[model samples]
Target: MRASAKIFWILGVFFLIVAIAYGFVTGTYEPHGIETVGFPAILALSGLGFMIAMALTLAYRKNSINPSDDLDAEVSREAGVQGSFSPYSWAPLWASLGAALCFLGVAAGWWIFAFGIMFAIYGVLSWVLEFSIGQHAH
Candidate 1:
């Protein structure tokens, strides 16, 4: 988790730099009412950085040491199942596709947005109950 946190922090900084560069390139020399690209990029990048800072702060409050982070830890200490993920699930793909459609529908039509909402709902529900109410139940 510490490694992940560091990676996100680096990404956050990189994004912040990119956003600043982008704003400069977009001719934001003086304050304006709004910008099509620069303002949103700055907001999103700063928000992402803030989110990572908050998440890392919260996680560190737990005070748990990661075996992987400990240089002196034994190799055997890391030899265990780490986390579980649904390998055979297609729900994520569907959900992402539905989300993409929803975004696209913003310029397309309300009908497309409605369909995307239904698709997203179905995908999310299937993902949640895939193991609880199916052959995969354990």
Candidate 2:
């Protein structure tokens, strides 16, 4: 995580520099229009956002160090039950179907949109409470 944060930070700085240089060059040719510098500006802003987010994560997680940060850390030391994860579930399929229906509704009619909304709600609720019922209850 530390390494990743550092990389993002560097990228952010690099993109910022590129954006500045691009703006300068483009400004010389076209003083009125922003079309030329928009892409680089977007890149610069995205990089800055990513860098700020990572910096915040590092600041917030002051004590939690990633295993990879330690040279002497062994694989076994890092290996453990990460968290609860569903091996298989129909939620994703339902959600996808709902999304498809919603898109179709946009081209079809409002009734289809209402159906999609209901289906999407069902998918989300079922996924959230999947383990609260049946054989997977806990």
Candidate 3:
């Protein structure tokens, strides 16, 4: 995990540097539209986000109890307490239907990004509702 974090950080820094360079190049030149350079900036920010994810993973790995340790059983019990739902319930159906609707919206030209937002929201809602219902029914 530490190694992965380091790699992510390195990639993030490289991407950030590239993004900065892109800004400079675009700022100095007028060969093409500014929007053409926006993608590189977006890519850089995405790399930075990946770095953040890696950092969080490293932190979690550091704090989590080892499976071979005496605290393993207790840790597992607590983990289970954090989720009392079965994903095998109606969650899959709802999520799949939501995904299909989102896809159709995107295909129909409702806006590509809007479809992504709707899909994400639907995913979260479906998970929450399924978890709640699954736990209660259990």
Candidate 4:
């Protein structure tokens, strides 16, 4: 779990850098709504978030509660549980679809701001769903 956390932190930073670069290259100076600050601000904020999450984990390392802490118990409990659960794999699919839709909306000039808003909602939903449900099922 600690390793996974470190990997996620690095991945988050990579995404943040790529997002900022994409915005700059496309000349979309503003990030959703933040004015003069622009995409750089968004990138910085994302990096900050990742850093904070990593810091939290490091700070709590002594008392860290990871899935491995109860590996056998968790495995046994899960072995007995059965149900038809929604596979959260669809969340990423939906989010990518939403991103495509957002791009088309921007290109067609059909509610330009709507794309940003929709993209934000889609991103949030995708992230929440993956974080809350995806890992447990697998």
lDDT of each: 0.78, 0.76, 0.63, 0.65
Cα lDDT of model 4 by residue, 1-138, tens digit: 465566668767886887667676656545554344556766776777687668756755866565544554465543644565555455656567667777877788778547656875877686666646556544
Candidates in order, TM-scores: namely 0.66, 0.64, 0.52, 0.33
Best-to-worst TM-score order: 1, 2, 3, 4
Least accurate stretch of 10 residues (summed lDDT) in model 4? 29-38
lDDT by residue (tens digit), candidate 1, 13-56 = 87888777776766555566345766686769777886987697
**Residue 32 in model 2: shift from native, Å?**
8.9
TM-score preference between candidates 1 and 2, better one: 1
List RMSD in Å for every model shown: 3.6, 4.2, 6.5, 10.4
Clashing pairs in 3: none
Error of 3 at 115 (Å): 11
Q: What residue runs in model 2 are displaced by over 4 Å at the alpha carbon?
A: 14-32, 35-52, 107-111
* Winner by lDDT: 1
Best by TM-score: 1
> Which digits, one per residue and each the tens of the lDDT, describe model 2 over residues 1-138?
666666677777777777776677667777674455585666768677676868856764896777877788889877888899776788878877888889999999989988998888888888889899766889
Candidate achieving higher lDDT, 1 or 4: 1
